[model samples]
Target: MFLASSAKPIDDNLKNFVDEIEAQSPSLSVLAARQFRYSLRQTPVELNIKEPRQFNVLEEFIIRAAIEFQPPPTEDELASVLGLDSVFIKTTTATLRSLQTLSATSPITVTPEGRSFYEKGSVPQPPYPIQINAITDPLSDKITFQSESLNETMINLPDLADFITIDKTIADIASLPLEEIQKSIQASGLALHIPEEGKIVASCKVVASTQKIWRKISLFVIFDALEDKLSIQIRNGKQILESASNWLEVLHSESRISLQALCKLSTEAINFEREAILKQKNTEIEARIEKIRKEALETSTKANNEIDKSKVLGEAVQLRNGQISLAFSEVLNSAKSQILIYSPWVNQAVVNEKFITLLQKLANRGVWILFGHGIARRQEDEDKPVPPEVEKKIRAIKTPDGLPSVQFFWLGDSHVKEVIVDKEIYLCGSHNWLSYRGDYLPRGESVYKVTIPHQVQEAYEFLANRFQNHAQKLWENALENRDFQMAVESLCVRGALGMEDIALKEIQNNNWLELLPVWLNVALQGLKSKNLPGDSESFKTALSLLSQVSIEETFIEQLQQGWRKVIGAIAINNPETALNLLSDEVWAQFIRLKIVQESDSPNDFILYRI
Candidate 1:
């Protein structure tokens, strides 16, 4: 509804033009009044008239302005000439341009069609004529008409004059009921037969001219009385055209039919039929496209499934740090029943927080987890203890059953790093199974994953058996060792007094050095035992007290080295082997350091300094 206007400023003459239109037509007075107000403010006016009659009035005003202006007018000049609002003039010009009645450039001029319609007072001409033939058999109840030139073309008109016994009835045709006339004709003996109820039969030979060539067409005209419409069907041809019933009514008048109106109606009918056919074709094309798309999608899905299957069964793939981590997580998440992981190194930093949470979730869903790491083979390896953080995380998992869903085992001889999920998928390689720091170091690793059921089952069984055998051997050796058995029993005593008695008895008997290995073995066992709360604080305190003793630098080095060896053995979660590495002298000094007589409580034994 926005108005556009010429850049020219408003003048006094524009105000006079507004007064003239306001006095001329009431239908245009509102626009004139709006223009007068805009002229006072020297601003462009806005017009929003929507009624058809109002548009006709506005069109007439524009035509008058076009005639008055000599060299085409600016929007303001035209508005001034017509006494219309500048905004109304702008809107009218824009609409005329869209209709191609006015040119679309500055200094707007009327188009040729506009000149004909407005300046010359011309009207739209039709494309063809409506023909009528004289009536025959006038005296009969059923009146018939035959074309003057074509005898076969006939129209069986209703005999209203005969039924009513009236004379000169054509003048009163409007008063007569066409339905009653139809009934009288149907009852008459001379009534021409029609195959359908609504159709009236007629035929004519039409000559259609294109360029200079004229083609003869034999066509039938059928009137549908129910719908009040007429259809022209070409004889022995598929093309059918329809027109309004008003065309036939014109023929019933004393005047000749308006052939121009009839031709326009015929063109409209043909255009409608073309549109329907186009719509049907579009629908068919869309359905075919949808079918093709669905087929393509189904084919693509099948091909992708085949590719995935091949990848799972193919040879091992080399992977970088990120790739290996992704592969491990993918395999772990896919586990349905159980997962077995074997790696020599395990740490909270390496295993990462995400993997830990994944383990927790899997355990909540009843998936069993078994982890194994290699036992320390050298004293230097002892520095790698089972990270206390990892143990705390494991303890935090609240499963349905009171027992932990995860189990840890130490591998004495094996160094293999692998992951097995559900006993069906196996991932084996140089990649560390538990700990992988992505892109932090230039480490090259690769792992192969296969779904070969036999190899997977064999690998799973071998690892499980190796862990079981190691645990059995450790248990048997612990039972055979008398000193180890006594140390474990003494460490199990709960009270301060019992700790004092054990510490004093060992130092007095001069067997405290033998007690050192046993005590470390018991501490490691406590860490790994599901039911035992790891007494790390006590072990740390005992070590600190032993350090306070007046031992030589070499002895101190041995003690520190022994401590690491025990921690490394425990890192692999093997307490029994860690105990075997401890010496008798180390254990003796450990007890002697805690035998201060000045200590008031048994727990105070650990608080004593040298």
Candidate 2:
């Protein structure tokens, strides 16, 4: 006798309402009872109705209202069509709106869904037949259900909504197991109240359960969607259970619900949430990478600059007065065996104390030291003697042989000033070693270390030979006239007349008196041995000077005495034999007494003596 049937389980309250109606109508026909039962199962029923009416007013109103109003009727118009007062119409429409049977904003037309509900002869198919879709908001602890039943009922279950804790994309939700999802929803405190039914369903079935770890915390959850409700289960690992559910009865009566809309909304929200999260993470990562790149580039640039500076230093070095001391120290310290210094003027005040100390140390180590200064008269208009302190320091230098370790010389004509170290390095420019005082000098000066090998060697050789010649000149100038006269007489006694003739001529001509002693020493040396100190430039120079002098009568007796010895030695065919015949030392006395006569040139002979 039933007009319609469904496999869906009916709520107890709905079944009880039908039972009460059947019990109250004892005279109701079987057909009427069957139709009423079917109606109750598929469509919402008015619990206040005590008996069946000839026409179902609610269904008729919905159908007729939809047909009459293209742009649905106003409340007044709708009331007129139904023959009801405006207040009654308003109240009925509100209920219809709540069920989604009518538009909430209106001309009072029936909803498309509402039309579908009543088209099946007041015995609509089971509502919300499609699967339920749900979304969760973890931060707000809310869950939103997208289902035809939920939308149709306009049920705002704040308690159940509050349970959703996380907002996720459709993909994320789909990928997550239903059990874990249920646990998350339950943890948010899911609960729903059915105000019309005066009932509350706080528990949900977990069709599936799952455990997952997120951010280092274990999460156990259950997720399921039953015919009448969408449910979730949440647990903190093994304890602290929580659950939530959205019941179908709370949203729509057994007869009316829609699943398509719910799925669409849920999918949209999920995609939006996922995109937003991924974009944020990507931006943060990119920013961090940019910062690191900048720092690395800055560091690399700094390193390159330092390397370039080092290269510059290796190629060449420039030094001024302030930096010259350090440069000098490096030059001196690098010396292994030789040090040569040349300065135009010599004075204690001009030389650095540290330089003097270093020189002394080098001298003690047997490193050859040559210190040159301009000739006293050639240095300036006024002659300057080597400072007393400088001489004392020089004299203090000790060597392995107990001989003077440092040789001092005068650069008579050359004005070059430079320092040479071990023939490997050299410094040249305007830096005056003997006169520079970095603090007192107003003029800027520079000294540079020579890097070219040939240049260093060339400079070293020039200075060395010049210093050697100057040293020789100094030693020769220290000899006295008697020293020279004795040297000449020694040669005469040896009957080396050829050499004596050369010496006599040197003494008479070119005022070679200063070098007479050196010449006589060489001649004496020749008489003592078969070979002289070989023919040196110095000996050749002496001979050249003698060639330029004219013989003078002032030395006739001395010359004749020397000539007689030479003649005797040669006649005997043995100079040593003749010299032995003259009784070795006697001729030196005559030559000293006779040859030491007054010179015609007072200027040349003023200090001369025999």
Candidate 3:
């Protein structure tokens, strides 16, 4: 489950071996040595010294050992592994010894006549003489390993095109042209190594060549993008591109001289194959989904524009040129069993005429009808009169028992306008369908209707939902009005009867202390007396005259009681005058009673405080 259980131990051991190697010399790994050679190549040409791989036997052993086993190597194992055929080793040693001696002997020399030659009797080319050296100089000794020997001894493998097929990984790959261009090498056969079978799988072509300075550099190249054949590399910025019209041009003129280039091309090919398959699949899926979404949206728009009776009221009614119109009376007249109306508006006169007529007609046909009517007005019209003419017309409609079959019921009136008929026809809009607000309107108003399937449970659900939405709005408005009334009455009662501190606290919290109108209104209730030093007696006179002008005997009695307290409280310092002004009931409250301690019996009861 965890990599540390096995992988960590192997890595730790590997690190220990690498650390020991590093302590001696950091340039112990083949990759580091190769990089060293690369760095040396990048140096300015003036300091160009031949590479020195052959000079140190241990260095040669570490490099080959690193390439084979990588780490945790034993000394004997590495040496045995690196020690190739002695014949080859001896030949390389001899060449190195000769070059070392030539470099030490002179600054410049041409031939045996001018300088001693190992060949002893041979003629030499001019530049060749300047280039030739004994195998003794450390720098020249490094050269023979890279020169004639490496090139001459390296074996060239035959192309195995006949035995190749596309790798199993890309059998599903159709044609991705860009991938073909990008996938030059992987899209087709490059090469593979099958060491167990003692074969290479035609993925790479290896070749050897000697440089002008007699150093050797191997080049590996892969053919990529058959339509636009390119030389691809795995670990380099450099490449050689050539167009091959056919396979013959590749076999003949396409120079496949470097084994390294083949590795680079194979890497690029593998990466391209994987990425292309995934990208293609994603592109196809996204294209299909986008096509579906676009088609669905187009279908929805078409449906929303459709017109006909099969659609509730049809899309024609939804047009926004600016009027919502409906005519659902036809639907009501056709009802078979029952009619139910759920209009939020219960306008008095209109309900008396059209609504009552509809309900009475439906009831006469033995169809049950339920109508809700009490959407309250701004203030209570609980005792308000109905026009006699509308009332007479409504009375004309009756059931078999000769009683009014149409009834109105409502919870409250806030802001709702709706209509339902026979549970099969429904209408709701900004305007009441009856002559309701229409009676007071200056011009045109808006209305709309929705026909219900009498059989659908959503009919009752639809009305119940409308009631719930408006009920919340009504409840919120009621709470706002209640809070305002409480705040106003709270200041009136408390400021009139409370201590100064309590009144001031209420004033401060009311946030209207700075508004002179509110302060005066709140303070006026606390005046206690009407006639002060500057009194014109206007308010007192108005109260005195109004008290006698009673609209109702009960109201007059309440006013009389209020006036008695108002005058008596002003004469508080004159108890005789207050007593004379008080009525019998008022005198009963002021004729104080004493508080007697319960600790004493009737014989010794004491009046302590009153």
Candidate 4:
């Protein structure tokens, strides 16, 4: 969600803007003034063609210099402008000549006099008539902007309407068989979408030969603008059974034309999911009923199994009081000569640190332990990305299989809690993994992921459906190749559709937004992804439900209280929500942030919907 603001770099006006920020919030003044002085030049760099780390250092030095220094046109300014300390400047300077390339035309190069003045600690005043044009497109991997011109317009990606026409043409095209489409597109492809009136802007293809198993070629159809809904001619693997409108069928008034088919697809997906959640709930209730019945039946029979039945009945009574661990131990102990562990989040923490040693010792004494957990992601970062600090010394362990192990797994929708040992050893209550959460540093205490064997089975089911047993790649924008992020986008935009419809239509084709004229703020924009988990989508749903005024306010509020919180940035562009961020006189910080440069700016950044 990078915004590109147009420039209104009037010298006196710019001076006044700087003066005001500094005067009102002098500290912010130093920080905010970078928008006025520094020029941002970004270009994509593929790994193959590279000049090593020269431009990397230069760019780092500039942003670092800009952010760190006060009244920063000095050596400190250079450091702040780049993202490093001054000690590296000499090496950076030596590398600059070998590094700098003017794909366009060379501007004035920095001379020794300029370097000496900066080296002598005098602020180098920026030359007047600052050249503030943004590098809208990258000529190559590395981009360098002149320090003088700091204000210019940045172009944005196109919308849905621009590239596709689905009403007639798309329907006709998607109707093709797999083989011909593969030959034409030069791959095996799935044509999943068609906009009602626009072009067939987006499509996905499967690489025919040597395509990795389960590997898919995702063709993201980015539209020029938001249309009401696409009218599509539908097909289900073989026959032209129906003509479904590829439209936004306002379920409760969102958008889209084809509601019935969409609903059908979505309902099926949701049914599969809901069955898993509800199954345990229903089974537990039935199991309780069955236990009482069995006890009555045993007493009625008065057979030799009477004592065993009474013991089982006695055990069942303890369930209401929650003696899960006792029950689990009983189950394990009662196992004549066989035992198996079915946990998704089993590590030292769940059973003690001596748990493994104990298990291995037990195994040597003839106990079979069947332990299971998903493989850990293989990462190669020498200096691991630091996790936020907590008082607890959390360290991951290497398993015998050469995988990092942790006692954390999702309960539902990628939750971070656990169900342990069995339905018996339950350890769940108010516990949170957060250390420096919000203003309350190390605030949250233990908010446990409830532990029960049934719950564990439920957790395993959810994980299997979602994670695909593979680690997600680390893409730059997160939006780049982010199939998961695309899911998030759908959850936000499409509201509460059945999981089936959500995946089939919303995610499979349209949700992935493309950045048009990609050179603009690739790095800064890429910084937006956070591993903030939980359903911010549910929040959106709650808000929509509130807008409908369908239920009592108190009821909604109560639901929210129990609702789980997730760590994801609120979709910055929810029309109802985002419209608030766009009222008159909201441009102050944007100006300071270089997001909006001119006061007379009629909003340089425009979001297109298709």
Candidate 5:
């Protein structure tokens, strides 16, 4: 059930890609993304190898003949009895005499070594500690030496619904023809040396136990808006394989066609997720609203004169609707450093001429205001523009330094309502500051006011963080966010993927010393594409920067190959410049490329390199 299954092992890169797609109304929408486990049948197999024992076949045969004979046959008699090859018999006897296996006399006689070898029945047999390469593909029936031996511990059974129906049966690896297996093993690129004759598959036993394991694949269902067609891309391990070719080959036709049904299921899943998220949010909002209403009722029933003024800064005080407006005015007049507010909506009823005058006075006094307002349940309402006059009035406020004092933000579909003054006083409740007309009958609107230092600061920070998070989401370019390191890493990836303009622009403008790694990455990718120009300076720059980082040997080798490629290209024209660019340290390792000057043409050189 991994097909439309909700469980997907998402890496950070894929998560960011999905988030970006969700952030905008891009033409391409991801319909489905999940891991599809592929079951690989691991059947145990036994393989054998032919190895040299203490003696070879011919030597053992001669010794056995001499020992078994009634009179212990002479060399002439033995050769005549065997096949009448006297010269061959003499040569073999000479070798045996050297090994102390036969006497140096005319007739062959068993020496001590020969007697013990016959008595012990020591003869050519399949070599023990067999060098077996047991890796095989059940589908293709191709054996490989690259894989480790399969064991019982790696077995896993798949649910009927989870795995694709494989058309092929488990291949009998043990029953395969020796020649075919030999060919397959050779193709695996292992440096296995095979004898010219008698390269035997001494024994092969197909073990009864078989293992089944699953491979996790990341499946992304894509919709082409222009074509009005649905297609799929799958990440099997590290590779995002080309469509249809690897898919049909691995999963078969039935599983390939079943992907079309995912569009409906994925749509329903997204809707379900949205509704669930909204339900959780509404529950929290309702709880906060109810708490405010309950507090308002309690406060309204009590006499305002009875509440001690000295206790206000030490604890929370519930305020009635009228007191809420009075507290807001007090915050505006008494604020010293900063003011932060969150209201669900903005209207002329509250943000009137008097409110503007109070806000302006605070700005003149050097107090900064951060204001956010927006709330909606529907898409159309969320998209509705803010009141133009409200925005203009808020925008007019200026700080003592002549910079804009008011930082205005529109919180999308938010339900939070609070105000924090100088990180000292906080007011949070169900009352809307700007939208409430204050003419309605007793509606139990309440505001919770607190002046505890920690509580006020915590509330202020929470609201501030929310605004920053929202701003990041609203940012048009992801790379422009505050995280410079992440932005640089992303730029490097993009540059490596052939978006050279971005890297080039950054390089031309910024300090190259800090971006050497980025330059190296781009050069490496360019080398892979085989599209780098002979005169390009990127490769040379990357090579010069290699001493700065501790790179892997494999990476250094690849970089060296790239350097040779660039040098070869450059040597075709301006050979002297290419020669000058080559460092002695790298040149020693890359001596395969030799440039020789032509006698006839003084300035001309011929180059040969790999």
Candidate 6:
């Protein structure tokens, strides 16, 4: 759009380009690579012409003198009257006569055309023809002229074509500003003798135009990951465009599919690299483990001691790559109440069939799993895509109640690699437990594993707060995208972090009353888990949201029943607020009839005669 000429054919050197990128920055790597066509519009227009004045100063003076003289002086007399040489005056008059500005005979007289020309600013030249083709760059919304239209072969992918459809309206010549038209004309290499200060566009008009022609431009999306940081960038054939302000705005406005494809590409690339690296290093790692076992066995035999079969260490210990892997596996398997993980990336390589099976088992045991991944430190780095395959598999794991046990949320900005299991163990380090496979090249990666309860609890709270802080942003984005399931997941995270009021505020502000059934279910779960207080602000807001649910609104019988039960539960917590909100008749029916009352346990409520 900035008029950098058309892009050449995209090169097939993507792999080499990625290799070069990784070489320059060992921590940065490309995940996926694809080339797609963006659109540009070309419009043909006719420009009306305005020529510069053709007469010289002497010539104009002589012509004016002849027109002023009452008798219309002869060429010789005109020369004398204007105080100019007769030879020069005669020659100038001959040229003017040829141009029909003066009579061809001996008299130097202003013709009808010459009189009009003199009165209208004394111009000597007639209008000439000017027309050109202008093209609009969709990205920058700038119009420019090209000698010929872009000739790139068009692709036929309907989805991509639809994605690249130009939404900005292109202004026609009539609608275009005069200065802009002139600028495009000048850029097209039109020869105009008139100074720019002169009215160049006053004589111009859009005589004709062709239909808008759209052409393709090559574009690239790149992902960078280094030092636990992650970012996505866009590039053209020339260079990275994310650095350009205009292109940055375009990237921000690009469709979610376009951006998701970029993230998918980067993840694919990383997965490919991870596979190759592990394939080469597995043998060496196995051999090293075998050697360590042999040494331990030999030392134990000499001391006549039994080697401990349980590898679970109850004290703080530093773990390298192999130890980190074993520890991650053990933590996932041994977790009884919860599992908290913070990694900037996730890949199928780590979450394979075995991992999926373990997650299912953990879900069955009701171990709450929270996985927060993102290291986008800047504003531009937010809204990254979670790998589709990874997300699908994780979300597939459900608890006995048919609800997801794992909650995945974007941290937006976090570099800490940690895994806390059941407040009994904490792991933190440089190693990416959910993403990285040890390199083929020997590199040291370590994480400190601590069993100290206070230390583990502290780490858990830190990671949980990260998810809560970013949950609101994710919730808003999900609602905007109409991703209801993700929206629910985001709110669940807030509930888990004891920020139910924030979640309720989102529901109230976003007009999410329809989701109240699910929200109340989450609230019930929180109460059961002993996380939410009976008289918390969350209960107060719940009563307010319930007041807004229209009585005339239609709902499924089951949902309506669930809604009543949750309302009764809320009354059990905030009885005065519920009485003040609900109709007195409704309260009497619920209380006087014993329809909703405390069961054997005070906190537990049952619906008796619904």
Query: Candidate 5: misplaced stretches above 4 Å?
Result: 1-35, 38-215, 218-273, 288-313, 364-366, 377-379, 382-384, 438-444, 452-462, 474-610
| Candidate closer to the true structure by TM-score (higher is better), 3 or 4 | 4
Candidate 2 TM-score, C-alpha based: 0.27
lDDT of 5 by residue, 318-423 (tens): 7776787788788768876567788878787777888888888876664657787777644247654568887888877664333355666665456768888766
lDDT tens readout by residue for model 2, 249-290: 223234233222221223243344334332432344344334
lDDT of 6 by residue, 1-610 (tens): 1111112122354555555655654234444444545555566555555443656788778778787777778877766766778888878787788656787786677787676666655555545555566777655556776545555454652333454444556676568777777777677675552444232433446444544444433343333322233344445544664433344345445633353443233344445444443232224323433443354345445432232422332335566766778878887899766678888778777777888899888877656688878767543575645678888999888765456777875654555577877667787777877777633333588667766455556566656655665566578788889787877787777765666777878888888776666677666655544456556666556655554556555533334555465556556666554444445444433343243442322223322211
The TM-score, computed over Cα atoms with residue i paired to residue i, of candidate 5 is: 0.39
Worst 10 residues of 1 by lDDT: 32-41
What are the per-model numbers of colliding residue pairs? 7, 21, 35, 69, 3, 5
Overall lDDT per candidate, in order of appearance: 0.44, 0.43, 0.33, 0.28, 0.55, 0.59
TM-score of every model versus the real structure: 0.27, 0.27, 0.23, 0.23, 0.39, 0.40
Clashes of 2: 21
Looking at candidate 5, the ten consecutive residues that score lowest on lDDT are 593-602
Model 4 ranges off by over 4 Å: 1-234, 238-254, 258-305, 308-398, 404-407, 413-610
Clashing pairs in 1: 386-571, 512-587, 512-588, 513-584, 513-587, 513-588, 516-587
**Regions more than 4 Å wrong, model 6:** 1-315, 320-326, 333-338, 364-366, 374-387, 399-402, 409-416, 422-424, 436-445, 451-458, 478-483, 533-537, 551-558, 561-610
Model 6, TM vs. native: 0.40
Winning model by lDDT: 6
For model 2 the local lDDT of residue 475 reads 31
Candidate 3 C-alpha RMSD relative to the actual structure = 38.9
lDDT of 4 by residue, 1-610 (tens): 1111112111232344434432432112111111111112322211111112123535444434433445434444455555668667544444443333111112213444233333333322222221111121111112122223333444242222222222332222224453333243222131211212111212222212211111111111111111111222222222322322122112214433222232222334334333443343334434433544453444546665764655443322223122434344454443222232323233333354443444433323322222223212222221322222210222232222111222222222111322233223322222211211223223333322222245434433433323222111112224465644333323321111112223223222432322110101111111122212123342233223222322233333322222111101122333333333434543343333233335434233322210
- Tell me the TM-score of model 4: 0.23
